[model samples]
Target: MRIGVVTFPGSLDDRDAGRAVRVAGGEAVALWHGDADLHGVDAVVLPGGFSYGDYLRCGAIARFAPVMQPLVDAARGGLPVLGICNGFQTLCESHLLPGALIRNDHRKFVCRDQRLRVESTATAWTSGYEQGQEIVVPLKNGEGGFVADQRTLDELEAEGRVVVRYLDDNPNGSYRDIAGITNARGNVVGLMPHPEHAVESLTGPTTDGLGFFTSVLEGLIRA
Candidate 1:
């Protein structure tokens, strides 16, 4: 499988995402934000980082990049899309996923190893994890808080769209301690944590994040 990792002007983890894909035994394709092509990648990942310096909201401006148009359409057509941190913000901004990301409730940028519960274990990006399993990965962001209206949150919860939940403690004050969520179709997923950052044992965080990338590969195989 060939996974495309998009790199916006200031994307901080594009390379790491690609490396993670390669490490997972998949081909990693570098995709430029300004280009409209997807380069025939089977899946796409929007990695973390401050794009366009985060000037007009976390991912508002980055969502308008030319490369994202095809992704929007493909995502709607059931192509797997995973967004981490800034990428998650972009996915929300693009309306591919529900809810909004706001400033952390503590009003500060946070960075640390975060424990997350695999709530759904069924999304295209999370199938490698067992349901209710806990995994630790690095999370860093300012606008990482996830919020949605009561009805929307209820629907997501009731329908099993809430993919991952914060375990132990809520690091970003996301509603219902949601760490990640999936679209109704289960093809598009977005989360605040950087799984790509924790793929290797040498990394400080646990190597549990490799599950995410490997999960997507399995998703493609099953498709």
Candidate 2:
């Protein structure tokens, strides 16, 4: 029940991510990009932000941080990792997840409450949702478009790796409106939406996002 939220230089939503973990009835551990240790956290969250100011592509530089190496290893070993927004870009750059997030098709930053359908409820971060369930979460990013080779796309589809999909319309021109995806092992997940921001009702995105954090806690407990 201990969730660590990693904060890279220039990370904006690390605090919010930690707060979400706390609200979900888990311990929140703050992790720094320069640190190499995970402090025995049961799970980790790569929160959104313009890491390294998004200087050379969204998450290119931040991927080389000390904290990410252990994350990659832990994630592969079945420790749950949730990456949001810029964090999604980092996951792709780290090769923990396939595909790259490109500039929005409109060539501008898009920010709104995005409605998404839970395409797969079997992953560690999505078990709280039933298949075909709809949830609203805030998504704000300039490089949220997802692209991959045709073969990889087909593989993802066949393997049921796609976790969430845009409901009504594609928000940022992502292929097949892929809102989120899980690794083959189903322990790691990455998405462009800001689920942490939607954890509270005052923000008005809906309380649905709480399921994501709670899902991990429940999954860990079951394991």
Candidate 3:
């Protein structure tokens, strides 16, 4: 499977995301932020970064990039899309996902190995995990708090769209301790934690995050 990893102007983890894709047995295609063409890739990852130096809010500016036009269209057509950290902010800004990531409650940047529970395995990126399974991955962000109105929050919980929930500790004060969530169709996921950073035991805290990449690959193959 060909997985495209988009690199915006200040993308920090595009290479790591590409490596994760390759490690999971998928072809990693480098995608430029200014290009609208998706290169016919089967899936796409919006890697974490300080795009445009996080100007005009975390992902506000990056959402207007030319590449986002096609990405938005493809994502709506059910193409698998994974957004991590800053990427998650972009997803929300693009209206592909709901809610917004705000400043951390503690008003500080946080980086740590965060424990999370798999709340749903229905999404393309999380099918490899068992429901309620626990895993740890690296989490790093300044404005990582997730918030939405009560209606949206309740809807997300009721629809089983909450893909992952923080365990033991809520590092960023995300509502309901949500670490990640999926779209209603389950093809799009936005996660705050960096799964790419946890794909290898040699460099990461654990190899638990490999499931995310492998899950998408397996789903693409089955399709």
Per-residue alpha-carbon lDDT of candidate 2 for residues 85-178, written as tens digits (9 for 90 to 100): 9898999999999999999998988888899989998899999999999889988988999999999889999999999898887888999899
How big is the positional error of residue 156 in model 2, measured in Å on the Cα after superposition? 0.8
lDDT digits (tens) for residues 6-117 of candidate 1: 9999999999999999989999999999999998899999999999999879999999999999989999999899999999999999999999999999998898999988
Give the lowest summed-lDDT range of ten residues in model 3.
164-173
Comparing 1 with 3 on TM-score, the higher-scoring candidate is 3
Q: Is candidate 1 or candidate 2 better by lDDT?
A: 1
Highest lDDT: give the candidate number.
3
Pairs of colliding residues, candidate 3? none
RMSD (CA, angstroms), candidate 1: 0.8
Comparing 1 and 3 on lDDT, the stronger one = 3
Candidate order (lDDT) = 3, 1, 2
Cα lDDT, all candidates: 0.93, 0.91, 0.95
* Best candidate (score: TM-score): 3
Q: What TM-score does each of the candidates earn?
A: 0.98, 0.98, 0.99
TM-score of 2: 0.98
